[model samples]
Target chain A: MSAPESILKAENLVKKYREFTLDHVSLNIPKGYIIGLIGPNGAGKSTTIKILMNIVKPNSGDVKIFGLDYKKHEKEIKNRIGYVGEVQYFYENKSVTWTGKFVSQYYKKWDENRFTALLNDFQISRTKKVRELSKGMRVKLAMAIALSHDAELIILDEPTSGLDPVVRREVLDILMDVTRDENKSVIISSHITEDITRIADYITFMINGKIHLTIEKDDLLSNWKKIHFKKGALNQEISQTLSNVKEGMFGSSGITDNYLKIKDKLSAAIEKEDIKVENVGLDDILISFVKGE
Target chain B: MIGIMKKNITFFIQYIGFLYPLMVLYWFLRKDSFDLPAIMISGFFFYLLISGSVNILESYEFKNNVYHFFKTLPLNAGDIVRAKFYNVLIAVFFLFTANSVIYSIIIPDKNMQVFSYIFILCCMLLTLNIIAVLYIGFFSIGFNKMGKLLWITLILWLVLTILSVEMYLIKLDANLLYAFISRINRMVWVIVTFAGFASYYGLMRIAIRQLEQNYDNV
Candidate 1:
């Protein structure tokens, strides 16, 4: 696709705690697309999102949402963004309708009709107390509330974790539909790669509080490849060129970003060493990067 | 801020307000005899107990990890702090009014001073609110520390505040302030009331700053 508008940009964002630190993180989120933030536990995915929301003040760095500084224009920026967390928080005894009523007043352009429609679609009872709703239902309820406001961006942290496959798919489908509007964007972080793989347009991989890579999903999928070689056929020179290379008793295996060029250079070696090449998926890419680290 | 107020009120009314206050009132009413001095001391302790316990109850709600939820809504740390401050302010006002009225009826002796009781109530509320501000402000830096330390500190602070306010109310020139309650000029009373309001606003500002700096911890 042609160049799209940049909806979010974070430059060298940093937050430190005794247990962990988010070191010099930056990413650009374009309008009208989904950017999947994928990482293992304690990878700072949640921290990045929190900084964007201005919920957690970063030790240093800048965050711009919709071209405005997040700090200076917090209320304006938050007003136009919808956010959902892995585990929702609400007064357990309060009814869903009370939550809606309480939350709707905060947004300027809240759509009552859209909220009602979403609740109906999600099959959630507005009269039911928050504690009565199942985990999946609570997530759906949060989604409904987020979508009801005419937000330009939706940021969800682990929206599909611990959820059943059917519910996960339903949530993903809803997210996919959300980006249909050209002015809208989404940033969803999840460890479940398949949930993001089906919907993400861009992928940003973070590990150990650092961003490993940020690239378009299509480009990543097209460029990165996995290769296998027969035992004792690989040398240090050839293995150094690949990523996450591992040598086993039976064979050698690795993944590479420069697949085409590497394939051309290793052609002679591939034929001689009986190497097998294959396209890699997000799961493989994540595991390779993590294991490599 | 209004949203936060509504949230806190809804939670309180639905969960604790319905039963807890009635119990406290029952305990207050079942007394065998109505001695003015005993009533004053007991009333102050009972109010402190209620306020402190409710504060603890709300802390449990925060433990449910609702700060993230508040962040998602269109509110900032200052707004949240303001909401909480006002909610507590309103509750304290209601308690003061209710207790003053009930005590006035119980001790129908014209010699018994009502303003002293009201004055003590205001002091107690202000002290408690300031403690809350200090607690929330210090809570962020102590994120890694054990909660027991925080609780112990809070309880200690509560005891200190209760003692200080009690001394200020009943022991500062006892004859002039408490015994000869009518002798205290109108201007002095106005000044004290103004001072109370001023202190509340000042503490609220501090609490707001504390919350802004530590919104993530909540």
Candidate 2:
């Protein structure tokens, strides 16, 4: 869209497995912004990230990182990307310093001073073996390595999955700091909507390997509403207008992005006090969509 | 390339220790003045044991999900396979030299023919190592398949060796077997050695292409 001022653009990415298929997934990650790829487990979030990283190939599609063809300029594009996957896979017997030294050799602009500073900031011991470190510490180490490489775009897949809240906040803050410079950007995929809302500028919600919505965070929040209707009022016409609906003993509640249109269609019900509308948070919106509520 | 080699060496350090028993066995066998065939058979098994550590290294990487880590880096499939090839060659060279030195020290009466024989054995083992890396990396064969392949190959070699030995004793007589072994001259040895190295790089190129094509599966 609009000629892709985006640092990362994936078009028509398709990958098939026995149980899952990432069906024609496409998304543009704009430059100088954080776009959260949000979805539930098994929603193809990791698959999409893998395709972007070239860890897995798409059956048919094109991915361009930094506007360079992913296949043709993979080495150059990867050099500019700092990525941390959902699982940590450092040599378990090696020290943190060894892992850092091993990884830093691949990056042209690896900054040892910055790496040391980040290690100090994160309180990770450089001499400690990777196997001796906890999962949270390993994540911090990964983040520190990713940041010290002068990467222009950071792609994190569930980087905060197992961390304590304190460390999670620290990681998010570090990501926010990365985006402070207008030239840097981030694309984080997570099931935790709150984490995305805390740091993301835009949101892309995915379900069953298909993208459900891609909108600005503020726009999504401003437009989507969870409307409740009295029992016997949720007829076929009203149901057709809502994206997801759940009926209970007392009434029916549903979500709709076209709040104004839904309100106009049910003006009679509104005046008669049969329906009420309330704003939905990012968490509620995602859960409603995921649960088909 | 040097960085990847360093990583592999470090990872394989624990495995190289297992070769000490083979060295000790070499000493005991030499004390009894074992025949050339017995020594060569022992050498083959020792080579197999040493190179088996490479399989261990691979299993650890696969178990820990380390393949994707390297795939995500600024390294192409050829670069990755080249690193592995070089690393394994270096390791094999080290182990081969160590085993040869043990054989030489324990069996002090051996002539120049022993050195030539060792050289041929080293080249042959190196060729097998290169071929193994190509097939395993290109096809994404896991440890189970590799273990099975190794077992089947070893069993087949054992059967062939027994059959050859039986034919030598029974049909052709021992003189015919000795004549065949004697016909291997320096020129032929040099040619075989050169061919071994040539085939190694040839397989390396093919493995790189296969790796690039099937990188996603890897």
Candidate 3:
């Protein structure tokens, strides 16, 4: 009956560039949950993650991870946080094993065996130079590093971008397995809605640096539905509750964010077979939001 | 911090490996002229060459956005800045010590007073080079801007070094300068060395602050 505690809380984060500004954005990520941040390009997802990681300073904002402030506890906070940037950066000439050894020195709880196991499982050659690996392999290497450090919170920025479907699925499955422990949390940012839908327990939709919605995955999918009805079936009162309404010769269709609220109101139309309802995918919902509908 | 230091040392080793053949060739050409001042000037020239090449390599690392990788690790700005400063200090000290030892072996006279003066001179030059490298590392505007600035700095340093050597060779007052340096008490030398170290620490603090505040821009 009690809500889960937030492992990461960000309040009114603001970062301004010459051309774009991350408007007053805020977020709360619950423990043991996967939070998928869905946004289009330049929507401030990477900027938000950078601010959270303290890689980029915000003009105005406060971020707390595990009840610790970055200003006073940067090393302590970062030690427990695993971050993967959009582009994997490493010494090109260094072997994979060398890179691992280099990174292991910085983490207090780095598990060497686990890292070696991950490298084996990911099929990344220990002696291969970083430049010799493919993009998918690079992502796996980054993921292996993130998961090898006993990190309490893993923040991935576009980790699956440009990967083949198989590799992407593997990455998602790895993330899912991480949350199975019930002590770890993940915040993954991506524009791919299907990947988010597959693994995210909570979904946050962002547009132009502002968070448009944050809701439970099941709640969002179940409550938000598309309704196809006769012209007169949807009254003005019920029509007001719907969004992205489209009228056609066959019938009119509209999306409703609160299907349960309007279920009783549409009972007559449903009973008479004058209206039909269909489940909406995250892509549909995201497209509607992106079009400013 | 140790990890960062190791990474820098690795880079130093790699660069030095590539430059070793050139260094050998330079030594072969100038081995006949080895003397107190000749050794000092050649050592200074070699320092400039190594530092310049290393600066370019450091710039390449920046261009590749390697700091992003460092930032992702559980490291604060101070750790990174200190590691960089320590790397420069250690490299300069190692080079000067090797130079002094080689000069003492090759030059038959081996005057203790002259060696002491040269040691002090090397220390001063090492301090100046360390400050220059650290300043450039922290405040590099951009890759192209850094290249241009490096060229300007290298030219200025070379001209100043050559002019000072020429002045010492030609001017009668040069003996007075040497006397002034030799006459300085041990306490003064200790204070000067202490001041050099203090400035190194102070510059490191400033670099750390700059990095913390302007990480994205850097």
lDDT of each: 0.77, 0.77, 0.80
The global Cα lDDT (0 to 1) of model 1 is: 0.77
B174 Cα displacement, candidate 2 (Å): 8.3
Higher-ranked by DockQ: 1 or 3: 3
Reference-based lDDT, residue A162, model 3: 97
Residue A62 lDDT in candidate 1 = 92
The global Cα lDDT (0 to 1) of model 2 is 0.77
Superposition error at A248 for model 3 (Å): 1.1
List candidate 3 stretches off by more than 4 Å: A269-272, B17-40, B108-140, B168-177
Q: Give per-residue CA lDDT, model 2, range A1-293, as digits (tens).
A: 37537788899999999999999999898888889999989999999998998888789999988889865787899899988889877878789998889888889999999999999999999999999999889889989988998999999999999889998999999889888988888999999888998999899999999999899887777678888889887778878878778889999988888776666677854555888888887888888777872
In model 1, which residue pairs have backbone atoms overlapping below 3 Å? none
TM-score between model 3 and native: 0.92
DockQ score for model 1: 0.58
Q: After superposition, how far is residue A252 of candidate 3 from its true place, in Å?
A: 0.7
What is candidate 1's lDDT per residue for A44-72, written digit by digit as tens?
Answer: 99999989888889999999999988556
